[model samples]
Target: MSDGADTGEAGEPGTEARPGLVRRFLLGLIVVLPMSAALIAGGAFLYGKWRFNAPGPAAAPTVVWLAPGHGLSSIAERLREAHVLDETGIFRLAVELNRAAGALKAGEYEIPAHASMADIVRILREGKSIVHRITVPEGLTSQEAMEIVRADPVLTGDMPPVPAEGSLLPETYNFSRGTTRAQIVQRMQKSASALINEAWPHRTANLPYKTQREAIILASIVEKETGLAAERPKVAAVFVNRLRKPMRLQSDPTIIYGITGGKGPLGRPIRQSELDRVTPYNTYQVDGLPPTPICNPGRASIEAVLNPPETNDLYFVADGTGGHAFASSLADHGRNVARWRQVEKKAVQVPVKAAEERTAGTKPVIPLKAPARHVGG
Candidate 1:
């Protein structure tokens, strides 16, 4: 009986130990399996980060347009298509990881060569799109300037009615895509008004014009008078001197504006009858400044009229060298006029000399008085 009892005790210990061994094996599996899984997950995260920051495959700068309402998945796909990103999955994962899915904006973007996925992500998040600019050159009539704006392919929407003449500023304007045409016109008008307000206070004292409109009116004439930058201040002085003397301005541009209404340049030279015809804008017949500005004047011309150099010059005539000769007295003006007539005479003879040679002893008739005209005072 004692031998049988000892054998049972030994067998009981073996049975208990088998269960403990099985439990230990299961616990080890639970701990080690999770550690292995965590290591794998961490390695994947680090590799993803490296790929997100790695340079893209684009060989040159690429321009991409992200339209409004584009989802993150679509943006990622587009970036892949444009060769800006290697794969869309990584871009999507990176954007989702950074919590920037909702921060992305729509617009045109110029991506640099070798831009990283991370760099592109930040750019779209901050809405840093490409900037576009259009320049309206100085001295364009309002109608002419509006035509330029209307012709731009980037700007959207129908243009508003043409603004009043000389009300729009002629300058380079910057805008984004999808900007309305009306907004651009408003910006121009605002710039014009702002410039007048800023420059009116600093004008020369005892100027002939009393109001801002009159100053602009005279400035428009100065803008049309000469294309030379150095001559603007001097030309403004001439008109100012004439206004002070109560002498007629007799500007040729003003007469042309009266006939064409600032729609465009008169294709032909001023005829003698058109000069003599009575009109509200005819400076030869009118006593003072015109009723309104003939065209949009730029900042230099506007500023020149406001602070013209002190001078007594009253007359200007073309010098046949794409500029005008200024004179302070009528006698000096007459001399300048005689020299200009010689220049004109030479210009006419060169073209018509062949015809004159066809008929022997017959002189080419180039009228000395108002013989087809040039813009002069």
Candidate 2:
């Protein structure tokens, strides 16, 4: 107590030791605050990463539609609503971190079950949408093909005007949802034009047709004459030979088209009165190719017309075997008709009755001098 200075043991408290205690407290705070903050930040980062990689809530594969002009936030919300994701925050974070925020595409997508948030982002950024197809079969008229496009539930918008006959290609066209019907029709037309352009250059020399349109006209007839793929070349050859000989095409489908105007199927066999009618499309009456295509011809039919094989066949009639009996002479064609009438007597009754019933019970007799003048003869 000589100078009355504060004195205490090292562990005891006193006024002089207060400064030391304060220094230690400040030092502890300095070290602990950074450590605590780092721990908290690490925990938050791990949680976000886990959510980003975790399996989604979709029980099965679910379809999600992202409309055009939607931002990233809107897409995330759509994903959450579709149950493809439990939340949107982690998904947004992941997409942003991967530097793919602007790469997401809009369309119909099929998200698989248990797909992680990373998987969803990757799918959208990669534009992996579901593919839908509309198959337009060969020999369908433009009106019929457009009817198919109009009836599709997935495609959007009203159909455009019916295209010209033989102007649209018949194939399985692929598209995503929300595609317009008009766009599909235009695509079909473009494909058809492209095909003709490509095939016209390689056409066989000395074709009877003077223009590409005439080629399409013949191809359309060939398409309707036979449904068998193997018979296309022969049927085309018959017509080509007939054209060279200046003989009548005498096709039944042309007669039907003249009667119905390619609006729909005739739904009955062609009658003699219809065939004898002097319409522009009735090949039996018309001298050469029809004014327009009867129906849309496929690629095979077009190719068959442009590059017919070498043959002298001038006549063809249905042989009751889902094919035609081709002959180079009228006598051979008549014999083939007789054989067909014998083999398909019951099948013959259908067309005969169709012709007779429409014409006041006047029966058609197969003349021996000319080809069989009945349907599928």
Candidate 3:
């Protein structure tokens, strides 16, 4: 029994004592070493990513003023140098990624320094830049347009040599502040070209004018001749018919344009002597269309020339109601003219003035008789 007990305690078959010291040490090492290595590698990876991905401190706000004609590379460099972008290469990459490389608009922009690449890309892509609006009214000469551009605070630089009269189309144009006057003038020229090209395709056939420029010149005359919108086509037709018959246009506005040189507004009414003035632009003296456009014709004026009113009437005179009376025969014109003159005389005889004067005057003043043929035609 003692022997069996000794064998069991020394070399037991079914029971085992605690593991050897070295074996225990190796098992503990096997579990701890890999866990320690994995923890160290994870910490290192996280630190590396944080160090690379984190951006630097916030930068100050910076103003980026983009003058006219500045290219994209110059603007990008400016942003990079201002520290608005950490690297221009990164910015370019971002622009390419967003497909905004070709979408950056030319204008002034304000970017905060140390702005993220994403922010800069958004600003350029969205074109949140400075904007200026210039309104050019109808019937203004190129010189008048230049004066407007020169006077505007948003536009910069001097006007180029004055464009041909009526070459610049009158419309509202949008540009960036600080854009050059020459650039704006060029834009006007382009607009005029485009408008004429587009309108020429739609013009009526068998017209008097051979080319679009002549049509524009005639339309300008018609625009300046009347303030009534409904009369534009009629006035255009009058000129067109006269041109077809090779008769003198005899338009009074042409005479005024010759006298004023298209610099300032003609503040007063036209006179007879001015109408008789001999100038290349004076339709009263010249038989055909004017040498050039007298004023900037608007789209309505252009369309009026393109499609003139169908009428056999050649003579038109103010009917004292903001519209003109059309007459086909001299006799009919005479009657209309007489009626218009009577209306004018009656309008001039103000009721208040006549009543007040009648009480003051002791001797009755004989009213002068208007001439039988003295009427507008």
Candidate 4:
């Protein structure tokens, strides 16, 4: 009986050792699994932080014009393609976490050199975009202005046909990127109409113009004649005084318009033949204002015509300077014209003499003294 008991005990002893080994294995797993999971999660968090805060890959400061319907995911993909971001998928995920995917605004955005992905996201969400400006100078024909609009690469839309002359108000227009050209033209027209409405009511009393159209037609002539802002009121007065006498307008710009139909620059000085040509727009031969405005007049020119300076000056001739000298009498005008011719003679000789001196390696001649007086001399 003792020997049988010993054999059974020996077999059961191995079974007991196996159970002990199994318990140790399970305990080790229980302790190591949580630690491994913690290490992995911590590593992932650190990697995300590094990526989110790191500078982007753009070589220089860049501008991205985000158009309408550009989603955050799409933008991220584009950034990845441009090497601006290393991980587009991670960027998209970050955007979702921030809850900003749906709030981004479309505009021209300046991305700083080496900006973080997070910086870009915040910039888009905050709607910080670059504003662009286009300044249409005063006195450009509508055709010329439309050419300016068509040439701007930033503006998008179907180009409108050339508008009528004197229609658009020339001014600096501000817009965000992706603005249409047609909208700008509409704004200009509306501004011009509004200005005319405001100024027409306060025009000088006893003016020959029965309608605002006449004033605009006359103002455009004055605009093309002189660039001097201060001289506009006097120029308007000279034309107005002539109109009262019922004399011909006789504006040189009108004759030029009659020849070219206001399409472009005549590219040369007016000839006697062109001045005598009897077109509907020819003020040299016509009895009153031209059929329409010669060019797009500015607000100042329009206002000047509507409110001319108090003067009875009948004629004005170019003085020795760029400005003109006014005369109320024909004899005074003849003297001014003679002085202007002398100034013209000197002007013609100056460039020729300068070139000759340069060719001969001689010192330049002193500037000729301006006439002591233009109108009275």
Candidate 5:
């Protein structure tokens, strides 16, 4: 009995120790591999964060333009090409994690100095882009205004179709980087229509304008006659009085529009030869308002023709100042024309610098708008 008990005790020690050895190996494995994996994962995650958040290579405020229809991958490549990023993989992952890959907008963005990838992505997602303003002044022909729009550096895309003359309203318009020229022209047309619709009903009675189109035509002339805002009503009165008698409008702007088709300025003073030249738009030869408006008249100019001040004046000439001198009688008009010639003579004597100051705004110049018929009228 004693020998059998000793042998069982020895076997028990060996069996218990084998189980302990297996338990120790399992515990070590569970602790070691997971901990090692965690350390590696943590290192990768920290590296990604640091790279994505680091400042870009731009030393100054830079403009970044993303064209329309570009995907996130293309944009990322562009950024890397612009030297704005060191690596693109992290940026891609960050954008995906934020679910912003499809939300990028096309526009010109003014990125700050040292902008991080996250900063750029946030800006692109939010569409915080650049805004540019273009102001179209009153009385510009559609062609002239379009020239300005075409030359603008802010707008993009192909040049839009030129609308009918006097279709666009004169005002300041705002646009983003990728805004098309056609879009701006369409906007102007809408604005002009609104102004016309608003002011058409308020025009004076017996205006001799058979249609709203005729009034707009007359308003365009009034706009071209003078640059003075205060003079618009008086200018409108001259045309209105003549129209009351149904006399020839005989405006010089009509003569110029006939010559150039509103595509460019006459670039010189009107001559007697050009005045006698018969054209559809020439008011001297035509009986009524021209076929269409000569230029895009502003709201005030349109308003002036719609509600002109009371006056008996039928003729006007420049009063040596920017404004015009008015007269009711043909004799008085002739006298005014004579004085205007004298003023013109004296103006020719002006120093080049002084003349430069007189028309410094570079608005179209009107020279010798009056001829023999205007003096007689």
Candidate 6:
């Protein structure tokens, strides 16, 4: 009986212990293996995210302009070629997620080297871009201004009919790529109108102009006559004095404008015979202001005409000093003209020799004059 009991007890314990150990081993393996695998996968994902989001080295990079008509695929390809973004597929996904495929503006854009796909998409969606500057110098005619506008490759659209003279302002204009020529012209007009309105209230008393247009006409003449900023009001005073005396304005640029038909720049200097031309723009033929302005005048020129300096001087000649010689009397003007003729004669004497010296890259001798001063005599 004792031997049988010991055998049964041992057999029962062995059978129970075997199943309990197996169950424990399997349970531990099932939970630990999955947990370990989960930790590994999480670490890998965190590493990838950190690598992509880290700040990059600072360096100057070239910028690329995305033109107005380029599609998303085209822009992506260009960005990839430039190495701005690592993966075009990722960029496409970002663009699609933001729904910004149609919101991109055509302009000059500066993309940083190795910019992230997300950053590029954000830049496009915001419509931020670089603005280009174009400066229109004072005294250009409307036709001349139009040519400059058309020559710019960034500007777009068909040009409209050229506007009347003095309708545009001369100043620096900021524009975007793909801007229209007509839009530029309109901006100029708006600027001109604003300037005229602001300056009209401050005009000097007893001005001969019956309207703002007349003032603009005279201002245009002053703009074409002198490049010296200090000399503008003095030049304007001469024309104003002439208008007060009901005498001819005798502006040479006006005569040239009539001869050229406003098609292009005047090539040659004015001749004595052409001054006698019967065109309405010829101030020597017509006793009053021309039918319109010959060129666009800037703010300073317009203001100079409206608020002429207190002077009675009425005649001026080039003093060969990059400024003009001013006189109030015919006798004084005659002497000034005589001196100018002497200078011209000397200049003509050595023309061929001067040409040879210029071709050889030698500085030509230029005569200097005394500092400009007011001459009442």
Best of the candidates, TM-score: 2
Ranking by lDDT: 1, 2, 5, 4, 6, 3
lDDT of 5 by residue, 1-377 (tens): 99999887776446768888999999999999999999998998898888788888878888878888998889888887776776788999999988999998888888888999988998898997898899999988998899999999877778887889888999999888778888998889999999999889877777777677877888899898888999999889988888888778888888888888988888887888887878888788778788899999999899999999999999887777667788998889888888878877755655554567677865433443332224224
* TM-score for each of the candidates: 0.86, 0.88, 0.65, 0.81, 0.79, 0.76
Q: Could you give candidate 6's per-residue lDDT for residues 64-140 as a string of tens digits? A: 67776889888888776766755566556556666888886666677766555556666677777878877889989
Q: For candidate 4, lDDT tens digit of each residue in 1-377?
A: 99999887787446768878999999999999999999998898778878988888887878886778988877887667666687787788878888888988888888888889888888888997998888889888888889899998888898987888898888999999888999888988898899999999998899989888888898898898777898899888988988999877778777777777767877777777876788877677778898888888999999999999889787887786668899888888898788788887887798789889989999887555433222122
Steric collisions counted per model? 0, 0, 0, 0, 0, 0
Q: What lDDT score goes with residue 245 in model 6?
A: 89
- Candidate ranking under TM-score, highest first, comes to 2, 1, 4, 5, 6, 3
lDDT of residue 365 for candidate 6 = 61
Off by over 4 Å in 5: 1-15, 28-47, 133-137, 149-161, 202-206, 276-279, 329-335, 348-377
TM-score of 5: 0.79
Output the worst ten-in-a-row residue range by lDDT, candidate 5.
368-377
Angstrom error at residue 181, model 2: 0.4
What are the per-residue Cα lDDT tens digits for candidate 3 across 1-377?
99988877777453353457668899999999999999998897566444334452236677676544655677678776766655565556546656776777766777755556666667777878866799988888888888898888878887799999888888999987667889999999899989989989888989988898898898888777676777889888877777887778877667767888888767677777876668797676778988988998888888999989788767777776667787767799888888887876876565555667779974444343222111124
Cα error, candidate 4, residue 137 (Å): 2.1
Query: Per-residue lDDT of 113-232 in model 2, one digit per residue for the tens?
Result: 989998898899899799999999999999899899989999999879999999999999999988999999999999999999999999999999989899999999999878899999
lDDT of each: 0.87, 0.87, 0.75, 0.83, 0.84, 0.79
Summed over model 3, clashes come to: 0
For model 2, the stretches where C-alpha displacement exceeds 4 angstroms are: 1-13, 346-377
Model 4 lDDT at residue 254: 79
Query: Candidate 5 at 188: error in angstroms?
Result: 3.1
Give candidate 4 misplaced runs (Cα > 4 Å).
1-46, 351-359, 363-377
